[model samples]
Target chain A: MNMHKYEKWWMLFGSGTLLIFLIVVGVSAFYMGSTPPYCATTLDPENVREHDSFQELGLKQLDDNEYSLTILASAFDYDVGNPEKVIEIPKGASVSIYATTTDVIHGFEIAGTNANMMLEPGYVSTNRYTFKNAGEYTLLCNEYCGVGHHLMAATIKVVE
Target chain B: MSKVEQREQTTDPHEDVDLKGTLFGVAIVGFFILFSWFGVWALFLSR
Candidate 1:
């Protein structure tokens, strides 16, 4: 076959680029444990209010600089347990957010942050994020549950 | 010119075409894809 030199080089370049992309994603998925959002942990939605963690939906210190924030997404509100719809934490603190819905599926997304999950009625979705900067981040529900979905939001205040 | 002389003087059209411009354009596109991919990848890893 008579192939031009430029065509041969172009094929190499294109194939090489694709190979690198596949290797990167493959390594991250298989070894580093980076994966897409999914539903694995589950519980009884009917009795969620009585569950150990669900009993108190708020932030709890787990370690020196680590914390766990339990949240319940109802019809159109997120109960972070606190009267104020805000989660205040020190900068650089690692917070594991466990979110679950009481009625329908809702999107748990923290604006400007990578903390996003899908909260299902009987399934528990969780995400961990360390707030490195001091700012007030918005927590909006990306999923439309009902007429009040637009009003569903929370606040994540990271203080330095 | 004679028919045989004219036929021999004709050159291959493809041989005269310069691929440098196409190469440069493709190189730009490839780098753009790579840089944007890294930007997203870095964001995902950093957060």
Candidate 2:
């Protein structure tokens, strides 16, 4: 069949570009075992508090410059084991955030950072992020659950 | 088939047509895709 030489080159170029994407995704997911941003493992949502990880819903320092934060999300509020709902950490610290919903679904998003998660009934969503800048980052439940959804928010204070 | 006919069949019909603009546009699009993919991947890995 008669075809433009440019068309032939274009086809090769387009297919080559697509192949690169597939290969990278395959290596990341299969070879390297990378899953979604968070949301790994499962648990009984009804017994979230009884679980070992969720027993103390607060910050735990794993090592220098590294910490783990756990949060329990319910209707109209986030039970972060603090009355003011403010979590303070030193600047440049890496934090692994884990959250789950006790009653309904909620969204866990740290403003000015990439730690966005969805708190499901029986699944725990987690993400690791470093606090590079020292400031107050608002944590909001972007997913609408009830009338108090707008009021359901916390603060992440990265102190210098 | 004769060698002369085979050569004629393989010849590009629009060989004289200038495709510099098309090639440039394709290259730009390809580069953008690569940039976006790697950028998001790196961000995901770090976070």
Candidate 3:
């Protein structure tokens, strides 16, 4: 088909840019492991308090320099083993955090860190992070659940 | 044919459009896309 020279160049430029974007996304998601959160595990929200993991929530050392932190999000509260308690872990330790919400949807975000996940009722969300330095990181709920949303926060203390 | 009719017949619609301006706009958009994508890679994905 007969086409203008400018039209041809524009078509080529558009398609090339689109191809580059797709390639970058594919590489980042597959090769570099920059993927969206996945939660196939489900449980009864009502029984979360009784569940073994939630019953004994908070940090547990699994191995040398490795730990697991289980958290339960409820109405305007984040229960890290005990409510209003600061979760403490050793610096330079790898922590795998598992969280679920019992009341409404909440956000699990460790301020000034890459640990962020959305906690929904009945579904378990998880994130793995390593704290390399000793500091106190604030854990805040980014999702608006109720009037006390502003008060829904906790502290993560990475001790040396 | 008259002079006016002859002039009209010779004019091309595509020639009237500014190709350089269009190309410049496309380049600007492409630049923003690349900048944003690389920013995400450097900040979020590179770790």
Candidate 4:
């Protein structure tokens, strides 16, 4: 087949670009520890509130700069426990967040950060993230649950 | 001019294109793709 030199060059360029993209994605996801949220654990929606973690839904410090945050989503609110109105964590601290919904499916998204998960009624979703900067980040539900979906928001205060 | 000569002259078979311009356009698009892919990777790794 007769082909123009420019066309051949363009084809090579396109293939090379695609290969580079695949390589970068594979390396980042596997080697660099960049992965999607995963939680195989499940619980009854009626008994989520009775669970140990859901009973005390808030941030708890673990050993060596690690923390665990539990959140329960129901209706249009995120129950992040008491005493702390806003989710507060120190900068550069690794945080693992576990969330479950009692009413319907909701989206757990933290603005300006990579913390996002889908909260199902009967399943627990977990995501781990590190707060590298000190700022106030907004947490919102991306999925539409009800008329109060727009009001489903919370604040995350990352302090130094 | 002869009929054959005039016919050949009038038949514009191949179109001329600027090689530099074509390659420049390809390079721009390739750079954009590379930049976007790297940006996504940076965001993922930083999280």
Q: Report lDDT per candidate.
A: 0.86, 0.85, 0.84, 0.85
**Total backbone clashes of candidate 3, pairs 3 or more residues apart or in separate chains:** 0
TM-score of each: 0.79, 0.73, 0.82, 0.81
Docking class of 4: acceptable
Across all models, the iRMS values in order are: 2.2, 2.6, 2.7, 3.4
| Candidate that beats the other on TM-score, 1 or 2, i.e. the better one | 1
Which residue pairs show backbone clashes in model 2?
Answer: none
Model 2 global lDDT (CA atoms, 0 to 1): 0.85
lDDT of 1 by residue, A1-160 (tens): 4455676777888999899999999999999877666667889998889888788788889999999999999989999888789988899998888889889989999888888888889988877778988999988999889999999999989999
Candidate 3 or 2, higher DockQ: 2
| Model 3 stretches with alpha carbons more than 4 Å out | B1-16
lDDT of 3: 0.84
Q: Which stretches of candidate 1 lie over 4 Å from their true place?
A: A26-36, B1-29
Candidate 1 docking quality: incorrect, acceptable, medium or high: acceptable
Q: Is candidate 3 or 4 superior in TM-score?
A: 3
Error of 2 at A99 (Å): 0.7
Interface RMSD of 2: 2.6
Compose the digit string of candidate 3's lDDT tens values, residues B1-47: 66765344555677677788878887788788878977876766433
lDDT (Cα, 0-100) at A51 in candidate 3: 77
- Tell me how candidate 4 scores on lDDT: 0.85
- For model 2, state the Cα shift of residue B26 in Å: 5.5
Q: After best superposition, candidate 4 residue B9: deviation in angstroms?
A: 25
TM-score of chain A, all candidates: 0.89, 0.84, 0.84, 0.92
